[model samples]
Target: MLARVAAAARVRPPERTGALLSATLVLSVGKGAFLATVMVYLLQIVGLTPLLATAGLTLWGAASAAVAVPTGLLVDRGRGRAVGSVAAVCAALLVPLSARVHTPWALLLVLCVAGGFDSAGNVVRRAMLAGAGGDSVKALAWARTVTNIGFALGALCSVRLLASRSPSAYETAYLLIGGGYLVMAACFATTSLGAGRRGSPSVRAPGVVGARSLRTGGALAAATGILTVHTTLLSTVLPLWVTRHASVPVSVLGWLVMLNSLIAVGGQLAVSRRAATREGALRCFRNSAVWTAGCCLLLGLVRFAPTGWQVVLLVAATIALTGGELLEAAGEWGLSAVLAAADEHGFYQSACVLGETTQGAAGPLLVAGLVTAAPVAGWIVLVAVLGAGRYIAGFTTPPPHKAIAIDS
Candidate 1:
């Protein structure tokens, strides 16, 4: 039964292209934890103030937000190897420079370069997976699972490094993350997914429709809005809240994040079976909205956390919010991919990131501003957004029946 269940869990890959794909997830998500905890590290350990940390975050999010699409463009234009290698080297430098520099301007500069390069690399890797299209959805799910695994492991590792080391722990973490990213570049450059490395997505065409056929004007907007709020809370907002509220002793955070990643990985795999169906897509999105909203309200109630047990409960609630991320991301990608035109694969994938990054950029600033004033109120706003997302998800029609594949 265990073997049967395990067999059912993994779909056969189109190609046995192993480490290159795995390394992409490892590099991107491993560094991504810094999106949340690094703020705390910068402020508390590096001696930057709250406002400066916030400013640095805001700058990073703003500087080259559409990098995903351009990264996609680079691949489409056949510059994949060049962009991927350059971005990897940049990733190696982005955070380490932060440790030495305390000036807001210098940090923001490195942060911008880092953000664009990181964003570019994310698309390159996804394009790599998309290049494996006959295995498309399942492949992406595995990619998601691998990325989440990296997320869990990276968060845990960062915490351990911070705990045992002295004040230099933040520097150590950044350097290691940079090295991992540089290694990622090496893996990509040398492996089967390299630009020179050749294979095609079953056909060099989207099986559903061509890019021009995708419902652009209204459908994209509706879908984008629904997905934006879901990811903002999951990736940025909740992480920030935990860092601020439950984070005096940071050792426990890695496990909590790991647990969060584990739930997401499972959710991504479990839902993969029926998740692409139109009904299934709508169902998951709405469910995540309600789940996240309920979790948000729970965030406001932390004042009522009476003891250590309650603190644990609070952490659990936050984990639920993070779990919702898995549901939203899997479904969102499914919908976007199924409805996208053949030529639009690049845009189709970039749409999700662009949507999420737009919200993520705003989410932190919203969080920073609100928390800087009234932390609880900031949380209340997230609940409101979640509720609205759920409502939108429920009311929206499935994609049009014209040349699309909403799965079985």
Candidate 2:
């Protein structure tokens, strides 16, 4: 599958292939390290109560989102290098600061800054990749695959430390994350991205990437909005819901989440292969939605579980939702690549991320409000809403306009 994708999206390496590889490595390792361990570290070691932790996560979401607007504009304006480089520095500095902090308020502030720079750097990378022609999917996949692997690897390491009955080890995770950022920063600074100007800024690829003629901005905005709602329901409300009504302990929750992450890491490459067909991709996405929504519905039926099967039911539901996550990820990256024009690629991709961040920002707050409003199955209600949103977004796509390729 990997070889096929590489072949299908043949990589005619951009000038400075070596540099881009370094950039990919640095970005993946740097961001992946802390990004993976953050949630677990906060919940397990930082001793943040769920409420404060959600707030900190919200801070990260909002800041990351706020940065996307300017970062997108900057990338479109072709000022990516500096913005990208600065992002690395901010990420590096913030990781260590985050390591030392105990106060929820302080972590909130640090996450905001960290999220902003991290997102900005990512947007710049998207723009740079869009500018590289002839192998957009492969390039994007390579980058994503690496980051996914890094996150899994980094998170495993952090988990071991946190599991060792030594709270101080949590700090070690943060420092390691900082080191990743530092390495990424250095990689970006020294690498030569221009391979004799072959894929230079002056040259434009033939696709719907840069040109705004058939603008799918409206389609993208609507689709992204719906998808964002789904994120909130799953990430914020679902966990809280399990805490409230499910037959589970805090420790059980950790393992439950682990199940999802394990599936994601193990399945991403397998799922990436399904992108070869648009309808097939959508079918997978739809199936995930159906299963996720169905699972959400099934939570209400847990009282009917067989003897000692309550945990089994919850685990099953979680796996279904994660399956949806897998499909959504595949569709998102593939469609973003297909929809973007060379010049405008960064903006569109950032738009997708922005949509996610915005929804993420709202998720915790919304979940908080709902719990306050109605303690009975509030999370379940929210999950249903998200499932609805996902279903709506999937079906409401505007009719395709003559099968336009991203880079014509």
Candidate 3:
């Protein structure tokens, strides 16, 4: 059954790949459902101040960041499936408890622990997806597409839930998220993943992967940093900038997010195929850099636009940013997958994820203070930062392994 599905989907290793995709879809829904309203839940149901809620979330992020490298190590040691399964179960059991926590410190501690497990689960899942087969890039692209669709649907649901503003609605969202994780765990449990599958190249590949890992990791990390600008802008920076500086209404933020997700869901697979080769990946990254820098500059000029024109400019900027993000995601997945040694993909990818982790941790702080204070100057600085990464990318070489070898 899965074989037929995989054949239709063009994913190899029919059964396992199908399972992974299904699991990814459900997992994404869960994540989107809860995250869309977590802040509201904390502020309204938990009765915490905005500062306290943000602080708790920040601490959770810190914990996730702290454990990422170690989790990668564990995944590489042939524990990817096990770790992900355990994480799913733990999340299922623990996530619902958030509703009962009243104080900030207690919420912080719960989230801190939950964050570590969540981070570990995510890294392991990515490692497993990368190891799916020769067309790991394609498989990941499919995963991303499904994730976006699921997230959009889930976010829509959360939006309706938010309208109610009832504690019961919030609890239901948490429980639904927990149930999603539980289902995802079962999916992982049934798959022949990690070191157990036949012809697992990672089992025969060299174990050390020392200096090679570092070189590849550093390059991918830079690429990740450049890509993160898209996320930081869409999620944190752009909304505030458009609302405060531009002539658009605050409601435009929701439309921008919806537009971004819609474009990704509709175009990710087609865009992903464009980065099938090393050169193609480089080109994608280059275009991403250019578009990102352009968007930043364009956004900087939004404030100077006529009242009616600001919305049009913001939409154009969003299109550029969205295109950059879509391309960057494809390029990142392709380059990182092809660059890492079969034996070292987990560790290498983890290092790459650190770029986003670091950016997520620091980007908000930078945007809140700088971008909020001076949107134009802040965006220009971002443009410079992304522009610098193009040179860094130039210095990066494809993995020493033949492209075919990496794919195999």
Sorted on TM-score, best first, the list reads: 3, 1, 2
What does candidate 1's lDDT look like per residue over 259-278, in tens digits? 66667766776665455665
lDDT for residue 42 in candidate 1, whole number 0-100: 68
Check candidate 3 and list the clashing pairs.
none
Off by over 4 Å in 1: 1-14, 28-37, 44-46, 164-173, 190-259, 277-279, 297-323, 367-384, 387-408
Per-candidate TM-score against the hidden true structure: 0.75, 0.73, 0.89
TM-score, predicted candidate 3 vs. hidden true structure: 0.89
Worst 10 residues of 3 by lDDT: 195-204
Q: Residue 396 lDDT in model 3? A: 51
lDDT of 3 by residue, 150-268 (tens): 88878877878889888877777788788878887887677776622323365344434465456667777776766677888888778777777876778888887888888887788
Worst 10 residues of 1 by lDDT: 194-203
Error of 1 at 403 (Å): 6.8
Per-residue lDDT value at 91 in model 1: 76
The models' CA-based lDDT, in order, is 0.62, 0.63, 0.75
1-408 per-residue lDDT for model 2 (tens digits): 899777646544434444565556645654555655677668877888887776787788789888885686666555666667789888878877887887878888998899898888777776666456655544555566566666556655555664664556656656666766666667656654411122334344422243442345434444555444435545555676666666666577678767877777667756756754556545554555565565556555554565357687777777877777677666665666665545566666677677677767775576567754766475477566656655555542345663345334
